[model samples]
Target: MSDPILKARGLNKRYGKVTAIDNCDFDLMPGEILAVIGDNGAGKSTLIKALSGAVQPDSGKIWLDGQEVAFASPNDARANGIETVYQTLAMSPALSITDNMFMGRELRKPGLMGKLFRTLDKKAMEDFAREKLAELGLMTIQNINQAVETLSGGQRQGVAVARAAAFGSRVIILDEPTAALGVKESRRVLELILDVRSRGIPIILISHNMPHVFEVADRIHIHRLGKRAAVIRPSDFSMSDAVAIMTGAMEPPASMAA
Candidate 1:
C-alpha cells in the first residue's frame, strides 16, 4: 500500500520488427515480492533488462523512489540502489568468495605514495563478507577464501545473492533464481528470497514456477506475449487462475488489462 520503490510505466522494447515488450507497467513496493510469470518468449527477460538498465526501452519512464530517472548502464542502476541477479550467476568460478564479493568495488587502504596507496584491505573485506553471508542464512560457509567453484549450486546462488545485497540496493531483481536447482536447493533459494523481502528491500522475481510464485510472492503479474496480462493479489487468486491468466485462458483484471 506504500508508494512503490520502483515503477515502470509504458515500458516498451523492440528488436527490429519483433515487439518483445509493449506498454508494460510494473511497480515494486518497499519490502514486497512481485512475481512475474509467463511462458517461454514472454518478454520477461526483455522487461527485466530494460528495468535493470542492461537495455534501453524504446518507450517508457522508470520512476525510482517516486522520481523519474534514466540509467545509462547497469552501473548507473547500481549507483541508484537497483541491483539485479541474472540467471547466469555472473561470477568467476576460480575467484575466492571475498574477491567475488568485492570484485568491482574493492576496499582499499592508504599507503606510502599515491600510486602505492591502493592496497586491498583483505581482513576487513573478509569480515564483512562473512557478516553478509550470515545475514543471508549462509552461515555454514566456513571459508570466505574458498574458490566459488567449490560451492554447491545452492551455495553458489547464496554467494551471488549476498553480493547483490551487499551492494546496498533498495530494489533487487532476480531472474529465474531457482530455475536449475534441485527441489531442496530451490526451496533454499526461495527462503533466501523471503529473507531478503523481510529486510525491507523490494524484489522483482521473474519465474515460471506457479507454485513457487504463489508461495513466495505478495502479488502476481502475468505477462502474456510481451504485455502485462494481469496483476492479482495472492489472496484473490488461486494457482489455477494465475495459470489461466498467464496462458490467456482468462481475461486479465480490468485495471491491469487496460
Candidate 2:
C-alpha cells in the first residue's frame, strides 16, 4: 500500500472546555473510499472540518502528499486539491448549473478581456461543466443552463458532487452525500460515488447510515468519545460489531486496531 494522500496527527479542538476533537489522528490513502462513522456528537464533523479548513484545530499537523500544510480557510484547502461538499450543498438555487459549478473559481476570457476587464468566459465554463457532467454520466441533467432551484434533490446532489469531481484534484470530502435522498436516489448517489473513485481520486465519506457505510467503504474509521476508536475493514467486522465499538460497548479486536 502507498503512503496516505492525506494525513493528520494529534488533532485537537475545543470550545470553552467542551472538547470537540481530542488527540485525533486520520489517514486517507490513495484511490480509496474511507468512511468516517460515529454516533451524534462523536466529533466526526469537527474532524472533517479541521481537515477541510472549515475549522482550525487548536494543535495538529496535516500533510498532503507528504508535504506539510496549514489551511487557514476552505479556499486554502481547495487550492491544495481538497474540496468538500457539505451536507447543505452550499449552492445558490437561482444560479444556473454551469454557474454553480464554477461558483468561486470562475473562468475568465483570454487576453485583456479576462486580464483587465475581468470578463467571465461563460462558453468555456459551460463547455467545461457540460463535459464534466457527461464524463460523470450526469448528463441526465439535460440542460446546463437550468436553474439549480428547478432541479430535484438528487439532481442537486449530483451537481454538487460533479463540481467537486471537476475541480478537486487530490481529495474530495463528502459529508453525508445520501442523507436527504429517496431510496432510488440514494442508490444513484452511491453509484456516483463509486464512479468518482473509479477516476482515481480518494474520497472521505462521512455518513451515519450503517448499511451504506458497510456497502461502499473499503475501511471504516469508528469515532468514539472525540477520537478514533478503531479502523476496521467492513468485511472483517459486522455492522453490529462496529456499533458496539462506537458506543463503547465492546473493544476492537487487536487485528483491527488503527
C-alpha TM-scores of all predictions: 0.95, 0.98
Q: For candidate 2, write residues 161-229 as lDDT tens digits.
A: 999999999999999999999999999999999999999999999998999999999989999888999
lDDT of each: 0.88, 0.95
Root-mean-square deviation per candidate: 1.5, 0.8
State candidate 2's TM-score: 0.98
What are the per-residue Cα lDDT tens digits for candidate 1 across 218-240?
98878889988888888888899
17: Cα error in model 1, Å:
0.6
